[model samples]
Target chain A: MDAMQIANSIPMWVACGIPVCLIIFQSLLFMSKARQASKDIGLSDDTVKKAIRASAITSIGPSLVILSGMLSLLVTVGGPVGWMRLSLIGSVMFEGIAAGIGTQQVGVTLGADPMTPTALAMAVWTMVLCSIGWVIFATFSASRMEKIQHKITGGSTKRMGIISGAAIVACFSSFVASHLIKANADVGFYFSKNAVAAILGALFMFIMMKISAKHKKLSEWNLTIAMVAAMILTAILPIGA
Target chain B: MNKEQKTEYFENTYMPKMHRYGKLIGVIGVLVSFIPPIVLAVVFKAIPDWGKLPAAFLTGAAAFGFLWIMEPIGYFNILGPVGTYMAFLSGNISNMRVPCSSMAQVSAGVEPGTEEGSLIATIGMAVSVLINVTILTIGVILGTVVLSKLPAGVVGALNYLLPALFGALLMQFGIKDIKYAIGMLLYCCVLYVLIYLGVFSWLPSAANWLPIITAVFGGIAFKLIVDSKKDKAAAAAEKKDE
Candidate 1:
C-alpha cells in the first residue's frame, strides 16, 4: 500500500490508538485516586462534584477548537494519525510544523503531495523527540514543585494562594492583553470581533458570578454561558467587520 | 485519619503512588508515542536514512525546545504534581488545564498549593481529559462529513470561542482580587505597546516572549510591592498599639 493507504489503514489507526488508550487509562486511574484521596481528606462530595461539573463544562469550547484544528490536520496526514495525535498530544501547531519539516527534508511539501514512507517516518521521529522533553521533565521534577512553592511562600498558605493567583492572572492577562492591544491599534471607534467577544465574555462571566452568588446553580454554567454568549454575539454583531 | 495524619498520608503514601503512576505513564507514553510512525515505517519499509536524522530532529526541536522546559517550570505551581503529569501527557496546558485546575480550586473554595487543592486540581484535569477525548473521538469519526456541511461563517465564529473562554477565565480569577488583575492587565498592555512600536526591534524574539516576560517580571514586582505595603501597614498598626 501507498503512504496514504498506510496512514489511513485500520492497523495504523489501532497503533495510533494505543497511546490514546493509555492516556484514558491513566486519567481514569488518577481520577479514582484523587476521588479516594479527597474522601480520605474529608473533602465534601459536593465540592468535588462541582469541580467536575465546572471543568467538564469549561472544556467544551477549547475541545471544539482542538477539533477544528484536527480537521485541518486530517487533510495533511490521513485520518488516523491526525485523530490520534490530536486526541493524545493535542498540540496542533507543533505537529503541523513538524510534519511540514518532515516533508521538507524529502523535498516534498506536506499538503501539496502524497507523502513518501520515508517522509512519514521522519515526521514521526521529529515530533516524538521534540515533544518528549515535557514528559521527561515532569517525570523527574513534578513532585519537587511543591517544595519550590513552599520556599517561595515561606510556608504561608495565604501567601502561596496569592502567588498562585497572581501567576494565573499574569499568564492569562498576556493572551487577553495581546488581543486587546491589537484591537486598540486602530485608534478610532474600531474594534475587532475578537476583542469585543473577549469583553462580552468577561462581562457575561461577571454577571453570572453575581447571579450565582444568590442562586448557586448558575456557577456551574458560568463558563459555558459566557463562551456561548460571546460566540453568538460575534456572529450577530458585525462589529469587527 | 485526622488532619495532620491525613496530610502525612497524602504526602507519604499518596504522593509516592502519584510519582509511580507518573513515571509509568511517562515511560509508556514515550514508548507508545512513537508507535504510529514506527509501525507505518516498518510496514512500508520507509525508514529514512541515518544521515538525515539529526537535522530532522533538530529542525523541529529548535522551534519549541524552549517551551518544553519553560512550560513545566512556569506552570508547575498552578498544576501541582498530579495535574502536571496528566497535563504534559494530554497537552494544551495553558489554555485548558490551567483554567480547569484554577476553576476547580476556586469553586471548591480551597487555597491552591494545599493537599485539598491538589486533589481537586487532579480531579478537574482528569475529567477534562475524559471530556476532551470523548469529543475528539466522536469528531474524528464523523468530522469530515459533519464539518464539511457546516457554514464557513459558523466555523469561523468557532475560532473566537477560545479567546472568549480565556477572557471569561481571567474574570473568574480576577473577581477575587480586582486590583491585581487590573495591574497585570496594564502591565501586559505596556509590553504589547512597546513591541508594537518597534522598541524591541533589536530583540526580535522578545516580541513573541512579551507575555511570559511580562508575566514573570510583572508578577514578582507586583508581589513585592504588595508585600512591602502590607509590612508597612502592620508596622504602623503596631506602633499605634505601643
Candidate 2:
C-alpha cells in the first residue's frame, strides 16, 4: 500500500487510538482525584465548579487554533497520526518540524516531495523519539521539583510566592515579546499584526477585569471576551497588510 | 480543615499519590507512543532505513533536546506537579494548558503558589485536556469539510489566537506587579532583538531559548534583590524601634 493508505489504515487508527485513549483516561483519573483532594483541603464546591467552567470555556479558542494547525498535519501525515500526536504529546509546530526532519533523513523534503511508506515510517519514528525526552524527564523529575522549589525560596512560603509570581510573569512576557516582534529575512525586525493583537488582547483583558470587578459574573468570561475582541480587532485592522 | 492540616494533607497524601500515578502513566505513555510506528513496520511492511535511524534521532534530539529540559523546569512553578504531568502528556502547554490553569486560579480567587492553587490548577488543566481532546477528535473527523466552508479571513485570524491568549495572560499576571511585568517584557524584547542581530550566534539555538532563560532567571533574581532590600528596610525600622 502507498503512504496515505497505510497511514489511514485500520491498524494505524487502532495504534494511534491507544495513546489518545490513554491521555483521556489519565485526565479523567487525575480530575477525579483532584476533586476529592480539593474537598479534603476545604476548597469550596463553588470555587471548583467555577474553575471547571472557566477552564472549559477558555479552552475552546485555543483548541480551535490547534484544529487549524491539525489541518496541515492531516494533509501531510494523514488523519490517524495527526489526531493522535496532537491529542497527545506534540504541538503543531513541533510535529511539522519533526516530520520534516524525519523525511529529510530519508532523502526527501516533506510536502515538497511525495511521501513514501519508508519516509512515513521515518517521520513517525523521529516524532516519537524526539518527544520521549519530555515524557521521561517530566516523569522522573516532577516529584523532585518541590525540593528545588524549597531550595530556591530558602524554605519561606512568602519568598516562594514572590519567585513563583516572577517566574510566571517572565515566562509569559517572553512569549508575548516573541509574538510581538517579527523578524524578516531582509529587514532586521518590525512590529506586525501579532503585536497589535497582543497589545489589544492585554488592553481588552484589562478592561474586562475592571468591568468584572463590579459585574462578578463577567470574570468567568473575561479571557474569552478579551481573546475574541483582540482577534477581531487585529483582523479588521490593516496594519500588517 | 485548618491551614496546617490542609498543607500536611496536600504534601503528604495528595502530592505523593499524584506523583506515583503520574510516573506510572508517563511510562505507559512513552511506551504507547511507539505503537503506531511499530504497527507501520510490522503490519504494513513499511520500514525506514535502519542505518539512518540514529541520524534522524540525533537530528530531532539536537533540535529539541534543550526544550525537553527547559520547558518542564520553566513551566513547573505555574503548572505545579499534577498539571505538569497532564500538560506534558497532552501537549499545548503554553497556549492551552497554562492559560486555562491561570484563568481557573483567577476565577477561583486562589494564589498561584499555594496548595489550593495547585489543586485548582490541576482541575483547570484536566478540564482543558478533556475539552481539547474532544474538540480535536471532532475537528479531525469533520475538519476538512468545515474548514473548507469557513471564510478565509476567519481561518487566517486563527493564527492570532495564540498571541492574543499570551497577551491576555501576561496582563493577568502582570497586573499583580506592573513594574516586573513591564521590565520583563522589555527585557525579553531586547533579548529578541539581540538574537535577531545574531549577537548570540555563537550559541546553538540561541534564538529559541535565550530570551526564556534570561527572562525567567532574571525575573527571579530581580525579585530576590527587591525582597532583600525590603527586608533590610524592615530590619532597620525594628532596630530604630529598639
Candidate 3:
C-alpha cells in the first residue's frame, strides 16, 4: 500500500486513537480530583461551573485555528495521524516542522516530493521522539517545582504570588514581542499584521476588562470579544503593512 | 476554608495524589506515543533506515529540545502541578491551555499561584482539553468540505489567532501590575532584538529560549530589588520614629 493508504488505514486509526483516549482519560481523572478539591477549599459550585464555562468558551477560537492547520497536516500525514497528534500532545507548528525534518532525513522534502512509506515511518518516529523529552522531564521534575518555588520565595505566599505573576508577565511579554517583530532579508525589521493583531488584542482586552469591572457579566466573554475584535481588525486593516 | 483545612487539602490530598497519578500517566503517555510508529513498522512493513534515525531525532532535538525542558519549568508557576500535567499532555500549551487557564482564574476571581487558583486552572485546562479534542475530531471528520469553502480572507486571519491570544493574555496579566508588565515587555522586546541581530552568537538556539529565561528571571530579580529598596526605606522611617 502507498504511504497515504497506510497512514489512514484502520490499524493506524486504532493505533493513534490510543493516545487520544489516554488524554481524555487523564483530563477527566484530573478534573474530578480538582472538583473535589475545589469543594474542599470552599469554592462555590457556581465558581467551578463559571470556570468551566469560561474556559470552554475561550477554547473554541484557538481550537478552530488548530483545525485549519490540521488541514495542512491531513494532506501531508493523512487524516488519522493528523487528528490524533493534534488532539493529543502535538501542536500544529511542532508537528509540521518535525515531520518535515523527518522526511528530509530521507532526502525527501515533505511537500515537494512523493511520500514513501519509509518517509512516513521516519516522520512518525521523529515526531514522537522529539516530544518525549517533555513527558520525561515532567514526570521527574514536576513534583520538585513547588519546592523550588518555596525556596525562591522563602516560603512566603505573598512573595510567591509576586514571583509567579512576574514570571507569567515575562512569559507572555516574550510571546507578544516575538509576534510583534519580524525580520526580513531586505527590510531589516518591520511590523506586520501579526503585530497589529497583538497590539489591538491587548488594547481590546484592556477595554473589555474596564467595562467588565462594571458590568460583571461581561467578564466571561472578555477574552473571546478581545480576540475576535483584534483578528477582524488585523484582517481588514493595512495598518502594519 | 480555614488555614488548617487548606493545608490538609494540599498536603494530604491534592499534591500527593496528583504527583503519583501524574507521573504514572506521563510514563504511560511516553510509552503509548511510540505505538503509531511501531505499528507502521510492524503492520505496514514501513520501517525507516535504522542508521539515519539518530540524525533525524537529533534534527528535531536541536530545534525543540530546549522547549522540552524550558516550557515545563517556565510554565509551572502559572499552571501549578495539576494544570501542568493536563497542559503538557493536551499540548497547545501557549495558545489554548494557558489562555483558558488564565481566563478561568480571572472569571472565577481566583489569584494565580494559590491553591484555589491551581484548582481553577485545572478545571479550565480539563475543559479546554475536552472541548479542543471534540472540535478537532469534528474538524477532522468534516473540515475538508467545510474549510475548502471558507473565504481566503477568513483563512488568512486564522494566522493571527495565536498572536491575538497572547496579546489578550498579556493584557489580562499585565493589569495586575502595570509596572512589571511594562518593564518585562520592554525587557523582552530588547532581548528579542538582540537575539534577532545575532548578538548572542555564542549561545546555541538562543532565539528559542534566551528571551524567556531572561525575562522570567530578570522580572523576578527586578521585583526583588525594588521590594528590598522599599523595605529599606520603611525601616529607616521606623528607626526615625523610634
Number of the predicted model whose lDDT against the real structure is largest: 2
What DockQ does each listed candidate score?
Answer: 0.67, 0.81, 0.80
Each model's Cα RMSD: 2.8, 1.4, 1.6
lDDT of 2 at B12: 89
lDDT per residue for candidate 1 within B111-161, as digits (tens), equals 776778889999989988888889888987885778677788878888788
- Candidate 1 at A150: error in angstroms? 2.2
Ranking the candidates on lDDT from highest down gives 2, 3, 1
lDDT of 2 by residue, B29-100 (tens): 999999999999999999988899889989988889988888888788777778888999999888889889
Question: Candidate 3, TM-score vs. the true structure?
Answer: 0.96
lDDT score at residue B216, model 2, on the 0-100 scale: 82
Tens-place lDDT per residue, model 1, A1-241, is: 6776767788888888898899999999999999998998889999999888878887887888888888877777778878777766557667788778776887778878777777777766666777888788876777687676667767665676666667787887877777676624466334567787788889988888888889876777888888889888877886874
Q: Among these predicted structures, which one has the highest DockQ?
A: 2
**Candidate 3 residue lDDT tens string, B49-99:** 788989999988888998888888878877777777777877988889988
User: Per-candidate TM-score, first chain only?
Assistant: 0.89, 0.96, 0.96
What tens digits encode model 2's per-residue C-alpha lDDT throughout A1-241?
A: 8898899888998999999999999999999999999999888899999999999999999999998888877877888999999989999789999998889988889888888999999999999999989988887888788688778777566786787788889989999999887788876577788999999999999999999999998889988999999999999998863
True-vs-predicted CA distance for residue A208, candidate 3, Å: 1.5
Candidate with the larger DockQ of 1 and 3: 3
- Candidate 2 overall Cα lDDT vs. reference? 0.88
- Residues A1-91, model 3: lDDT tens digits: 9998999899998999899999999989999999999998899999999999999999999998998889888888888889888977798
Model 3 / residue B241 / CA error / Å = 4.8
